[model samples]
Target: MRVFDAKLKLQSQLRLMRSENNTIGMVPTMGALHEGHLALVRQALSENDVVVVSIFINPTQFNNPEDLNKYPRSMEQDSKLLSELSEELLIFAPGIREMYPESVESVSYNFDGIEEVMEGKHRPGHFDGVATIVEALLRAVSPDRAYFGEKDYQQLQIVRKLVSQKQLPIEIMGCPIVREPSGLAMSSRNERLPKRLRKEASFIYKTLQAAKVKFGTESAIEVSDWVDNEFNIHPDLELEYFEIADAETLRPIRRKQKENKYRAFIAVYAEGIRLIDNIALN
Candidate 1:
């Protein structure tokens, strides 16, 4: 597989692909490859003739400095995993300087109305940076399709808006959220969790499931309280924010919006490892 770290080379490769009208798929990742990341690669492999994986940890997306510092990176190991997937897949692993060649004076996004709740409110400039980099990537690769994990459902949604608003020629595809046998969502940050706490982390999903079960029958307030109570069982966990929101808008549901399926999204801190999970609220 060809590896291009510089924009010039990547553009050259892309132009050549465009010339031949080759169908290319992209799996954008922040490295620290896990089964979830590989599942995206698997989907790409199955769909497109060429798969280009970008492994750049975009710094601007991170709201917390500590979180950025602790974000996992295993370049050698990740490269090996991708190679095992196939020698046909090309990897674009670039550094911050290369990706952001110009002084980015500002980066923000009007995510319709979805940016006000859950992740957007919690991590202020996160989705903006997410849009910035992913936008740059889509422009760079100009792939027929791009694969994203459904774990970050909100982010995936924003990417779709980007393609529509910006008029980019790319299909935003969301693959399933890969989980472990114990039901813990497979995440790169899972590597940072203390081994013991790792097993306990599965409760996030359990609590979200409980919230899903309680959704329409009870008030959003009651469901949130129940989630908080379930979380209290784990001393190591710190409740950041929990809410059942309109899945598309990411706003707190005041009444039953039967027209749209709502989602219960939660973020919690346990042993300094932040984890997020969501389930559809029927």
Candidate 2:
């Protein structure tokens, strides 16, 4: 595996690959790799001649300072795990200094309302930072295909928009969300959960499952209320938001929704760490 920290050198090498008609796949990650990340890497390996994984914990994406301070980081362990997966894998491990040599300001392309709701509303400039770093990474890697897990469904959609609008010559593909057999979605943040709470964490998925079952019969408001009540039953779980929104736009449904289709997005604080999951209801 070849690793490069400098953006120029990585871009130069990537250009050579494109020149030679080698298919390139990019998997952008925040490090502290988990099954969710490995799933993306494996997908990239299957479809492209070369797989490139980026490990940069972007600081600008964090709206909460304390959460930023607490996010996991294990470079050697992450690299070791990736090494065994694909011998031809390329790693872009740029330091904050290397990534952002200037001020924290980012010249970003926004999706207007799309960038201002759900995860965006909760995290403030979180997605803006995400968009910025992603644009940088996409430009640097310039992969023929980029893979993202549906675990971050909204973010993946936004990236698809970015790629489409920017005409960046990249295909943004959303892989299935990897989950533990118990139903809890796999996440790097899962490591922060206390063991006991980790087990209780599966309840989040169960609640969503119940919500999904209501589908055509229940009103959006009704299903949302049930999810809220389910979280109420588990007082240990701090409910952030349980909402039904437009799948493409991520906007809440104030009244009845047409096409009777929407996405169920939920975020809760379990064991002091926030876990998010979503399902599509049609």
Candidate 3:
């Protein structure tokens, strides 16, 4: 596998591939490779002639400076992990200056109301950072398709909206959420969890599952309350926010709509590390 830290050189190579009619797939990441990340790259490799995995920990995406500092960075380890998957893979590991030559601030975007709820509500400018880095990466790579994990269902929806509004000719593919055997959703942040808390973190998914079961006989608000209560009783996990919202609009609903699909989104703090997960209801 070859790594390109320079955007110009990477784009120049991609242009050659374009001339040869090679379909390019992109898997954008923030380093600290995990199975979940590898899963995206695997899907990209299967479908596209060439896959470009960009591993730049975007500073613009972190609203909290501490979270940004604590975020994992293991390029050598990440590169080795990718190499085991495919030698044909291209790695775009650019420096902060390379990604943002002028300023490092996130550019604001109006992703309808999709950017104003759940994560958006909690993290303030988090989605703006997400939109900014994703737009920059999309522009830099210009791949035929880009892959994202469904674990971040909200971000997935917002990215689709961003592409539609921008009229970008690229397919945004949402892969399934990879989980541990205990059902904890795989996240780069999972690394920060204490050993015991890591096991306790499975409760987060269990609560989501129970909430799903309750949704059939209970109201959205009722199910949400149950989820809240479950976390309240848990010793290690603290619930940040749990909402059953329209899967498309991501607006929390009071009652389930017969015409609309619903999903339960939850965020919990295991110690100081934040972990998030979501499940479809009906």
* Model 1 lDDT tens row, 1-282: 778898779888878877887899999999999999999999999999889999998888888988889888888899999999999888999877787888752377787867656888888888888999999888888899999998998898889988999999899998988998878888988888897888888888878877777885888888888888877777878889898888777778767856887888888888777898777776
Residues 64-160 of candidate 3: C-alpha lDDT, one tens digit per residue: 8999999888988998999999999999989989988999889989998999999999999999999999998999999999999999999999999
Best model per TM-score: 3
lDDT of 2 by residue, 20-46 (tens): 888999999999998889989999999
Model 2 / residue 170 / CA error / Å: 1.0
Cα lDDT for residue 36, candidate 1: 97
Q: How far off is residue 198 in model 3, in Å?
A: 0.4
Local distance difference test scores for all models: 0.86, 0.87, 0.93
Clashes of 2: 0
Ranking by TM-score: 3, 2, 1
Cα deviation at 200, candidate 1, in Å, is 1.0
User: In candidate 1, what residue range of length 10 has the lowest lDDT sum?
Assistant: 104-113
Model 1 scores a TM of 0.95
- Residue runs of model 2 more than 4 Å from their true location after superposition: 254-260
Question: After superposition, which runs of candidate 3 have C-alpha atoms over 4 Å from their true positions?
Answer: none
